[model samples]
Target: MPRGEKSAYTDKQKRQAEHIEESEREQGRSKEDAERIAWATVNKQDGGGKKSGSGRAKPH
Candidate 1:
């Protein structure tokens, strides 16, 4: 994947990032910085979109 591309992320992950970004922005972060932090948080929580062979599992 290219830098900054988010095609591997799930819908819920995207939503989480959006919420995080908004929260960061409200706390005075720049848009770019907030987005970066948000994505990092989602990655930290979801392990970067890794999947099991069986099927989609429940979110923690």
Candidate 2:
């Protein structure tokens, strides 16, 4: 699943996320800014790649 998974966002994390978002809003982050931030965070955490795991299906 993608990083935006609701289960991943705890109450504390949610608050922090919202604060940063609102601050970004004030800073005029723009749509592209939000997208880039999300993509960069996810990619950085995922070894600078687009996905968390290798691009392969799970073995059944």
Q: Which candidate should be chosen as best, given TM-score against the real structure?
A: 1
Put down candidate 2 lDDT per residue, 5-44, tens digits, no spaces: 5454445544555565566667778866765565455434
Ten-residue segment with the worst summed lDDT in candidate 2? 43-52
Candidate 1 residue lDDT tens string, 1-60: 888889888888999999999999999999999999999999988889646578777676
Clashing pairs in 1: none
Please report, in order, the local distance difference test score of every candidate based on alpha carbons.
0.90, 0.53
* Candidate 2, superposed: residue stretches over 4 Å from native: 35-60
